[model samples]
Target: MRIYFLSRRKLILLLMFLITIGGLLTINLLTQTIPSLVRTPGTYYMAKTQEKVVALTFDDGPDPVDTPDILNILKEKDVRATFFVLGKAAESNPALLKRLVKEGHEIGNHGFTHDYQQRKLVAEMNQTDQVVFNSTGNHTYFYRPPGGLVSKTQMEATKRNGHVVALWSVDSKDWRNPGVKQIIDNVMKNVFPGAIILMHDGGYQRTQTVKSLEPILNALKASGYRFVTLSELRTLDSDLK
Candidate 1:
């Protein structure tokens, strides 16, 4: 077998390539970790409280069927939740938006569409806010970005629009059409006091979500967990401070 060696120039190029890859990896790591380290103002993932309370937030809704089902469950359980709705959906189902407010549930802007393009973030937020205001006769102060995604510019725009970014801590992953048991387990395993539990009322078939709701509510209520809206959860956090 003949042995081959890289030339000095080729060796230098290989070293440079490795260094470039390392730098990119470092940047990716920092991008993932730094947000957890530095908290953005007016943005909340979970409230800072130990009151055995959690906020139930539903996104991508005002769905004609699923929203009503979820609402019925919440009404039956005597629990209030926050619904982050898309403008297009709300426009189509204005009555659902009105019903949400009438039932003591909070409304939050989830943008105009499910698209999460950064450049249209503010525009989408504004459009959704307008739709909500038109339907509910009340302005929304909370904005949960579509898919829980945010950027510096998006955060800045959200602040400028006077909306607090509402994010969730416990994700049920029901969007994946995970089985009812798995959805319940996903939440039960991760839930904590002041957790903002993420579930979806729309954007796909949510039968599992609706089916999982009563059991999850029963389990949490039995554990002495009270469900509150995102606004109430924020108020609790403020009271702690």
Candidate 2:
């Protein structure tokens, strides 16, 4: 019989290496289970382009109060953004949906009840699409699931609805009601060409988000970045392809 023992220092180093590898594997698995942003290849996180352009997207909107304020801000900035609206919200505020189209902003479906169940999502998406078309005569080409949650089944349903799943490359984390400065920093730090920035308008008290937008927009513009709606970003991607 032969016996061998690793030196204490070498054993510690080997254990550290194994721990690191295990941590990485766990992270990879967790990311795969969740809806992905930039690292997921098949997901539409953002466009791949060199045009110094990005898409600013807001979710859960058409709020009578916050949505109007957000629209005012975007109008003042002369920027067109994409708004993913709830079907219920749109039905209640059909005029707001028309305002989105009138302002040249794009409207996408955010589900009827913000539900992500596969079968429910298909119905929700279809209902929202009809509401949007009836309200604004504009068909929603993008579907961003509530909380960006999507299963393979949900993805297939979205495709069947003739909508592309549009996720985001940069999340402002403003939903937590983080300070205005922190929200600005989160976005400014991650801003990049073809990045789709995620923010919200109607989910809750979104004052901080609205407050953060102006500074973030000014900073990005000063950095020579152009803002586009998500559909426009897709056009850029299609051209590239």
Candidate 1 lDDT over residue span 90-127, tens digit each: 99999999999999999988888778664688788889
Q: Across residues 1-241, which tens digit of lDDT does each residue of candidate 2 receive?
A: 8998999999999999999999999998765544334434346888888888999999888899899999999999999999999998899999999999999999988999876454588788889999999988888999888777777777777787789888899888887777999999989998888899999989788999989999998999999999999878988984457
Off by over 4 Å in 1: 1-42, 238-240
Task: Give me the overall lDDT of model 2.
Answer: 0.86
Please list the C-alpha lDDT of all candidates, in the order they appear: 0.86, 0.86
Candidate no. 2 TM-score: 0.83
